[model samples]
Target: MKTYTVNELLKGEQLLQQVKVNGWIRTFRSNRFIALNDGSTLNNIQCVVDFEDTPEDTLKKLNTGAAVCIEGTLVESQGKGQKYEVQVERIEVLGTSDPETYPIQPKKHSLEFLREKAHLRVRTNTFSAVMRVRSALSFAIHQYFRDNGFYYVHTPVITGSDAEGAGEMFRVSTLDAKNPPLTEDGKVDFKEDFFGKETNLTVSGQLEAEAYAMALGKVYTFGPTFRAENSNTSRHLAEFWMIEPEVAFLDLMGNMDLAEDFIKSVIRYVLDHCREDLEFLEQRLLQEEKGKPQNERSEMSLIEKLHFVLDNNFKRVSYTEAIEILKRSKPNKKKKFQYIIEEWGADLQSEHERYLVEKHFNAPVILFDYPAKIKAFYMRMNEDGNTVRAMDILFPGIGEIVGGSQREERLDVLKERVAALGIPEEELWWYLDLRKFGTAVHSGFGLGFERLVLFVTGMTNIRDVIPFPRTPQNAEF
Candidate 1:
């Protein structure tokens, strides 16, 4: 007999049609009713099996988490509560699961406990819903970029240099740890390693995407990225995904427009395609203390918030103006900030970013023209002597979702900035060569994929969204 997907069964119009469905039992109540989810959709089919129809011995052996195939007739329920249910004709146990051995039970399991059994957590209702949403969101991302004439670029995972320049890298090596290869000066010699030099997992694909964008005019990369920052906070992850888009002949405004449109499209797509899953989450999985409330928070949901941010023109202010607003704000009155916001130079922290987006603008805000001394050397220096033409997109819940700018196209100025930043000229010769050959104006942004997922799903912790999350001192499977 041909098998049907659970989602297909739900959408089918043929009631009382004989169908065969296979899945693990989610829950079985009173041996007469069983809820089975195939992982094809968030909605699980409730099968009504009489004790006489299912042999007493067979019924006794069946348990939650056991894989089973059911031959049933789909019927519109005359019962008041549920719309439809399956009337079981015959059942076959493909695999029996011992209730005591199964890690997931019908009882409430904490997120910490769930994380330990990450491999099996997807079988649960909450995780099944989350994974479906995650899959839908990923598809939406590719669709948005592909529809907009952006070429999908696959950048390398193993790289020779750090793209973020943040100095947090997980080294790739084959040398013995106890007695490693050493140079004449008693330093660890990376030349003896597999790559014949220092190599590490890529922190970002932005730099490589820029090269592709220069040639292809528009390109985006979606891939795994690593960071070795020893942070155990809810927001920090050692390994996570990043979506970066680079466009040639695009200025700062164009970059922002693309970012805004890309984000909004993904949100709209996921909301439309994963309505059932999202609704399930909004109703049961989410709560006020444990999860988000079902009631709509804003005039628009998170998906609509993206459209609102994109449809309405964004508020753009220079770093100087933002600092002035901060200085005048009430929080600045009580205690001295660790990074004071002054006129010419000061780094913006999470608090300052939140204040601008949440308090001052009451919407998504873009702050640009940061002091060159603080920003990356690749950012284009503004006409003003002090600041560079970099921009950061700050959202209400998350501080900075995107960081991008028009790149420094002039080789002479770029070289000067590189020198002033104390980076060796030889290390970046290939990057400078692009400027020497044929450099047109190019811009791009590095978006934290987890942050975007958090904002869209209303998930508070970044760790919950990702599977097998890696954090500081936590790499347990």
Candidate 2:
């Protein structure tokens, strides 16, 4: 007897061979047909059972979500929609599920309902396909970096530095919460806590990755990063993964090239390897779009959108140029935009970004040379003294998929920017030390992993792409 996965059995032929399979029952129909899935693929294996010979007790336990092992013979399926079927010779119930208690029934469920049942949602077709694509994208990310001479670095999850300087951080404390140590000024003192200083979950790993890039020339960090912003939207997540890559000698132009190439490589990999899953997600998106108004529907299908990105060159436009375009656009002119683009220095919103990608350019766009005041302190200041060499890669549906910049290498300039932002110099002494010692014109970008998955999977909500989404006031498994 041989053990084979449902994927292999479906794609290969071992006619009349005795095989063993372990899986959970997806559905049992007519007291003779069993649909078993083992998490190996999206398709399930139809196992034909001999109801007359099989014990009644065993048959009774073959309900949905019940784990089972079956000794069966591989044979061609008499039914349609699948290639192979298993003729069960012996059946053993590993774990039984009460049909009345199982929440994931064989019917369409809303995304909200499936989210509450996140633990069992993977058993469904949509979630399982999503997760498979997510896994493929993750693997492609690492493979792309590895093949491109980038060393993977694991950055700290807890740090004292506020990388984004937004200050929306979840504090890590070990002292008593009710009555903790207080400074003479009556503020809660963090000196007595672990690490002997204030620390929180990291918002971005770019700062740490910069240090490694300086030492190793090229390095990347792919790990979980936290943001404590109380945002309840389709795009925000309290805890999410980030992919940051830093190169010591790369400039802003080189950074844009790298980001574009990296994105295309990963998408290409997924398109080649995860075709089945992508097709399933594409059809899912098509069916979802049918309910929306004709004007609101997507102009391109999900797979067509993917190919469009791969086939076209990303249009590189300056932030100043984009501002003018948005200002002249009908939406901003008619006050239809939620936040109209009024001036050159005004920050561009997601609406504006989507306009550039989806409407104006009709291709991927990379906007650079943003106003220095709106960008982080690390971005390199251009000669104008008003703008920095920061760039954002905008996709059609997703606004800003990748954000990067050539870092400020001058110690005095960086220190001035840090002081202007009210960030204490002592807190970033180590970061300042990099510029003091051997700083170069390094550039890097941070890509929100969920947003990438959301784009690739054509999933509207960020929560659906990740396994256990951590959002504002919602952390249930």
Candidate 3:
């Protein structure tokens, strides 16, 4: 007898063959039927028990969440909703879960409640589907990059330089907190720290990837990045994964093309490979939105929204043009926007980005040439001297799905921007060296991997999509 997964046995490939299966019991009904799942698929395989021949002790241990191994002959199910089941001839309990203590139950539980039990949330249908789609999307990301002549690069997780230059970084010093080494001026001395200097978790891999792109021509990094921002919003996460791709000679326009093509390619792969999980999530979203008002609901279903992105070409609009449109739109005129688009330099919020995508363009929109002051120091300065060659790809629900810029390859111009921002040149000397040696017109974008997962899975909260969400003041498990 060969051991088979619930997913394999459910396929009816070896009907009449004796099979051994191991899974956690989902439900044991009437002491004769066991619904078993082994995390192989969302669907469970029915294991019909022989109550007459099975020992009473063995049957008693076959409760929900109990791990069990069943030796049975596969047969076509006479039951409804499923095609095949197992006729159990022998059974052994691997681990017994106490029903009274198990946190997960068969009934519908609140997402909030599930978050508390994040350790075991994957056992639920919604989360199982979500994680499966997440896995597929991960594979799709690497596959797309590999097939497109890009090399995968692993950037350091801890570094001395701040990539975002926002200064909201989690310190990685292995020094005493209360009684640390003091400098001559009485400030905590970082010279005695583990790395002999200050370091923190990386905020983004773009800077490092740029270095690699200079050598490798095309390279990408898929890894975890940290932020110390104290935000409790549904969209904010203290820790998240980012997919950043850097190309040696790609401009802003070419960067936009790559972002669009890359997103569509991975999404199409998920649509092709993870249909069952995606369909399950689609229905889950439909049910979740049923209680909301008609105006608040999505016009297209989850699957429809994904196809809409793939089928349509993203509209390209300049920052100045978008400001003009927003200033003249009904939302701005009627004071419907929470943050009014009063001027060109005002950073666009989620509401403004949503209007451009959902109303103004009625399609995905890529806004470019953001004001230099609002963008980071690395973006290429435009000829006008007011804006940088930066672009943000906005989606229907998520405001900005991708952000990128043509990095400033001109050594003098980049130094000016860095000095203007008061960033010390020494902190980024290695980065400046790339421009000194062999810099070309290069561009890349950072896609928040969780946001993409959120969009694909129709998961509203950023926390629900990640395995262990690190948020403000909450680091449990």
TM-scores for all predictions? 0.93, 0.99, 0.99
All-Cα superposition RMSD per candidate = 2.8, 0.9, 0.8
| Per-model CA lDDT versus the true structure | 0.82, 0.93, 0.94
Worst 10 residues of 3 by lDDT: 57-66
Best by lDDT: 3
> How well is each residue in 1-477 modelled by candidate 2, as lDDT tens digits?
778888888875777788899999999999999999998898999999999999898999999999999998898888897788999999999999999999988899999999999999999999999999899999999999999999999999999999988999988879899999999999988889988998899999999999999999999999999999999999999999999999999999999999999999999999999999889999999999999999789999999999989999999999999999999999999998999888889988898999999999999999999999899999999999999999999998889999999999899999989999999999999999999898889999999999999999999999899999999889877
Q: Show model 3 residue runs off by greater than 4 Å.
A: none
lDDT of 1 by residue, 94-120 (tens): 999999899999888887788889989
Candidate 2: 10-residue stretch with minimal lDDT = 7-16
Candidate 1 lDDT at 270 equals 75
